[model samples]
Target: MGRGQLLGREDGAAVFSSRTIAVAPGDDRVELGFRFSGTEVVVPDDARVVTNGAVVFGSVDCGAACAGTGTGPEITVDTSGAFGSVDVRTVTEAAADRADGDDD
Candidate 1:
């Protein structure tokens, strides 16, 4: 969410505004969808994204192939147990994916 911006909680979900780093509690089976437009999202070394649903990617990480100022906005889905059953990580190319693109 934006700096100090409160998205306000409703039900059991917390929404975050774009353009800043934020962390919120997540369901065990969290669904992750990411679209940076012209920006990039980084997955920290310790981040674990898993699910029992459908997965199109074996794994993905924000490598040099993704360009950023290293301080862009981020949303961290952190949770476990019944609330952290499944997690989805979705990423659509703002630009085209390259066959030679370097990803970590």
Candidate 2:
């Protein structure tokens, strides 16, 4: 048996081990952005519960909302928290191209 090895001589018995990572303050940041059709939303604050580039919650926040650029629908969330999970879905090409690139 090695120093890092687990010894289990019984049935249906198991042992597990894990390592932890420590992050310093202002060391991590999260940016979430999305584009839709003809509108956009961009939040440049690097904090939790941020709105209009302002820090509504959490520390290490931004003073103002980031100015949005470019066309089309979009939403952006800039945060200083960890992103444990995310889910995304988009329309199919057939539905998106129904207007033949024409805006009326």
Candidate lDDT values, in order = 0.28, 0.24
Candidate 2: tens digits of C-alpha lDDT, residues 1-104:
11111112242111122111111233222233222111112121332222222222222222222223323223333422221212211122223333477221
Q: Write one digit per residue (lDDT tens) for candidate 1, span 37-97.
A: 1112323323343222222322233343124323433433322212112222223331224
Least accurate stretch of 10 residues (summed lDDT) in model 2?
A: 12-21
| TM-score, prediction 2 | 0.16
What's the lDDT of the predicted structure labeled candidate 2? 0.24
Candidate 2 backbone clash number: 8
Give the CA lDDT, 0 to 100, for residue 38 in model 1. Answer: 16
| Clash pairs detected, candidate 1 | 27-83, 27-84, 28-83, 28-84, 28-85, 28-86, 29-85, 29-86, 30-86, 32-88
Q: TM-scores for all candidates? A: 0.21, 0.16
| Candidate achieving the largest TM-score | 1
